[model samples]
Target: MAQVKLSAAGERFFGTNVTPRSFEQWIAFLRLELKKTQRKRITASHNLHSIYLRHNNPDMAEFYARADDCFIDGMPVRRLFELFSSNAGFNHRFTLMDNLPQFLMAAQREKWRIYYLGSTEHVAQKSLERIRREYPNLDMHLHHGYIKDNAAVVDNINKHSPDILLLGMGMPLQERWLLENFEQLEFGWVVQAGATLDYFTGEQAKPPRWLSAAGLGWLYRLAHDPRRLARRYLFEPWWLIAPIYRHWRLQRQENGTPRT
Candidate 1:
């Protein structure tokens, strides 16, 4: 079946977004593409408050929107997709906490090697230690994140040539880094996982399981760090949510559904 697509204010998302199926399909596609890959990539949609993000951070939002494939990772987006599909359940639904494990499992099963990039050397070190603790058999060669000079980072990445590269640095910078440098790297797939290392290394906590499952992960995050997140959740919707609501409503009207 064709994926139901929604384009809201110049951004796009699927109608039935399942994390695992999307990821697994990504792997299958990447495996094929990587065989001919002079440069191929994968990126996740950690958060794009859509219009707000674009208006406020046009550079980052544009770069992210341009990725070869962008998976919607959070519950808000997943549910946004689920709105159009009945079964809506696909096996691989994991956050970065879950994504890394899936990747590790894939590496173990297929013997694919990974390179860890981004974050401080200390965070990188601690991340490797923790992953080893969790998945003892997984193989990873680590590199410290985005060397100040792009040329050198590309050179080193080309040399290592791992199967997958996980980037922990935040958006636009990370996306730009990959877009500019991915041509030189040998990795089959590159995933941008914002603050993924921090979460893995116990530096940050994900929303509690209940909150996440209930699609209140944003609420949980807002509760945990209101000082930082509140501004985003509040003022951002004026630019982001408002536009999406208009689009979703337009979608409903186009479908001839009764207005709520």
Candidate 2:
């Protein structure tokens, strides 16, 4: 397969390179990539947890560094990019939940095969059922994330040979799985789809438009599952302070400005 060339230029945030693409541009990029036969490509998204992981976890850092394309999925990340990046264009947060429907519709039209791997078996079943009802013509496949044999799962995926692979096994796990088996995977695009299936299945409540637009979606998620997210939302960000400060100083130096 010929390499599909696409321009996704951007500045580095902390240690991760992020492409500040608008929702439309992101969709367009995906469409173009899907149209071509190319080597395995993985799309990664960033948020506070991901940023923190990049700083602390070597495996996570390597995954981000090797990602084919990265986007801002968190409002805080988008805000930081606006503060740090000098180049100006649309810098929107591209969450899978917000964009999955449109992309799936496009997949339907294009006859692209999609394989989603994540969520509980129940949630996965529900999501598949919903997709069947809504998009009967769309070629979609699903497998729950709890797998005993990684190789067998890889074999199953290869058998399907999907055009797009939606991996939603959650942070480091999803990232780690791809990093480990990237060479074995046969797909045009591997999307980091964290918790998107849950949202799609209505297992998790979707935040209101105003809250998501106002950048308080984290707060809403925290309110819903405080025990699971308290540390991530409240304490993990504190760990990022030192790295963010160092990045700020480096940015200042690069721009020939005195560090305040």
Over the full model, what C-alpha lDDT does candidate 1 score relative to the true structure? 0.61
> Residue 61 deviation, candidate 1, in Å?
4.0
- Say which candidate scores most in lDDT: 2
Tens digits of per-residue lDDT for model 1, 91-205: 2234665456676766766667677778778888887787778778777866667477767667777787777787777655676677666556777678777677876676665
| Alpha-carbon runs more than 4 Å astray in model 2 | 1-8, 256-260
* Residue lDDT tens for model 2, 117-208: 99899999988888999899999999999988989999989998998899999988998888889888888888889899888877887887
- Where does candidate 1 stray beyond 4 Å? 1-39, 46-56, 84-93, 132-137, 249-260
RMSD of 1: 5.9
Q: Which ten residues in a row have the lowest lDDT in candidate 1?
A: 8-17
